[model samples]
Target: MTSGPSSAALLLLADGRLPAGGHAHSGGVEAAVVDGGIRDIGDLEEFLRGRLATSGLVTAAFAAATRRSCPANGPVPDGIITELDIELDARTPSPAQRAASRAQGRALLRAGRAAWPGLSCPLSAPHQPVTFGIVAAAAGLSPADAALAVVYGAVSGPASAAVRLLGLNPLAVTALLARLSPDVEATADAATVLSERPPADLPALTGPRLDLLAERHRAAEIRMFAS
Candidate 1:
């Protein structure tokens, strides 16, 4: 994969402020917090670490793989993107998580189209990481760049929610993220290497608690975050 200085486009995509509808979702942290799985800063740290290890690594891998699937100048093939989407869906067993992913994907697709003309995917709503990979490629980002954005979002999303859900100090939360930097980088590096494999061969590590929390959140009559 081609490498260069971190492009401004990468920053734009990775920024949490991007209007991709991600702010509404907490990456399952809201559900966990409500379920008593996270009550303080220490619990939040462990949750973020677990998330980074499982879904974070898997999403990063798919993002890298998807970026490789889409050529820099050619239109993405329907069959190939579909296969990747299916593979990601299989990895996410929770229906709530699948629905949340598609919702975010649709929002991200709309935002990407505004910034990168001609950016289109076969599916109206692909998985979030798949859309992320496609958009990253459209913005002239490398596979590793895509992986970086995915893994970062994997933990950052939950951390953002934890602050709101648990009333955790923002400074502490930011510091926690700073401390997790090495882990985030390690996860991204591993994902980039795993991206060299076929989509079906990618890792399928999961957190059952995340799945249960997603289901519980979906059923809750009162909720702060979407999932």
Candidate 2:
């Protein structure tokens, strides 16, 4: 309601180094490597592209919607948030992935609450993207910024993991990320269009291979990333 969040807030949230426990998760890259879905930078490109389109778009939409739902003043409505949570659950088909998202969400909430108490987030256990939107609202950012932040993380997390998992050159990986920025922005814009949609009307984009990898990652006795 007030001036939407500033560009500084957007940068802070999009920062991969932000202490949200995101470094520990690979955004499914670890499982993909274990499953032989990714072997080199070429394969990583494909994986990143698919993730940016599917899970990336879906989560970004939720975050933008959540950002839009927050009131400029007064307590947040828990009922609406509850419905949003359910919508998130409906979109994510994998239990392991769900737990992973909630974990990241909780971590981000902790950081966000400490950083900006003004946002007055209502939930203790939101999906990562949902919490991200609330944090953006608290930071005074717009829905478009929220979408960009979450979508950027969706791709960057895995790209970073690819560095560790595959021992690929970081410079090349970064360049790949730069090349993909246009798609990320496009996806963010598309999500912003649906930010005001009803929860039932939110995007439902599932990645079957990612889901299977998450399940397999959960069962693995020894794993590098959380999900």
Candidate 3:
């Protein structure tokens, strides 16, 4: 069996460190929790599963697709990247959520470019998945690996946030990760297949309830998360 990249590097992208500003956004979990939609750990898991099925899956697919399309040692393609960005923008209906994703994407790009030179990242107009895919490619991770990392990051960010907001047990939360590993792997596999195709061929499976909550959360005066 061929060994993949160093575990340390994979951890760097997946560790939730690297200064991506992901901590500031909760992937709509905060709104769900505050509104009583996500009341316990079970609710948190369900919410994250739905997110993975929709935006999370789409984002991973785009990232993996970009990685697949990008040359191993050539300039990143701007056109495809732009297409993914616009797609993400259209999918994210809530203004607040759009702003949040862009803000985080820009931050991730800035940090990624600084850490890995020769990384070509667009300005902050596009959403997070675009920037994330570019950064992952620059980091030398394969498309499948990038897809898995992106999917894991998307789900874990909110899961971590729930730990703080709901005061859930850390051990239990870690255990949840183990249980959800299969789902994450499956999503990544699906994303990789989708990435091979054009964005037009991609399915539009965004969650309306999540969008509604994000809109309502934006109107709130006091909020812990950016979106």
Q: What overall lDDT goes with each candidate model?
A: 0.91, 0.88, 0.80
Error (Å) of candidate 1 at residue 87 is 0.5
Worst 10 residues of 3 by lDDT: 1-10
Query: What lDDT does candidate 3 reach at residue 43?
Result: 93
Tens-digit per-residue lDDT, 35-153, candidate 1: 78899999999999999989999999999999988998789878878989999999999999999999999999999999988998999999999999999889888889999989999
lDDT of 3 by residue, 1-227 (tens): 00366344557878777798898788888888888998888998888889889887888887787777677667887788777777777777778778888888888888878978888754554577778778777877778877888899878999998998889998888888888989999998998888888876665678888788889888989989887
In model 1, where is the ten-residue run with the lowest total lDDT?
1-10
lDDT tens readout by residue for model 2, 92-204: 99999999999999999988988887656567789999898888877878888899888889899999999999899999999999999999999999998987899899999
TM-score rank order:
1, 2, 3
Q: Itemize residue pairs with steric clashes in candidate 3.
A: none
* Model 2, C-alpha of 57: deviation from truth (Å): 0.8
TM-scores, one per candidate? 0.97, 0.96, 0.93
Q: Which is the winner by TM-score between candidate 1 and candidate 3?
A: 1
How many pairs of residues collide in model 2?
2
Q: List pairs with backbone clashes in candidate 1.
A: none
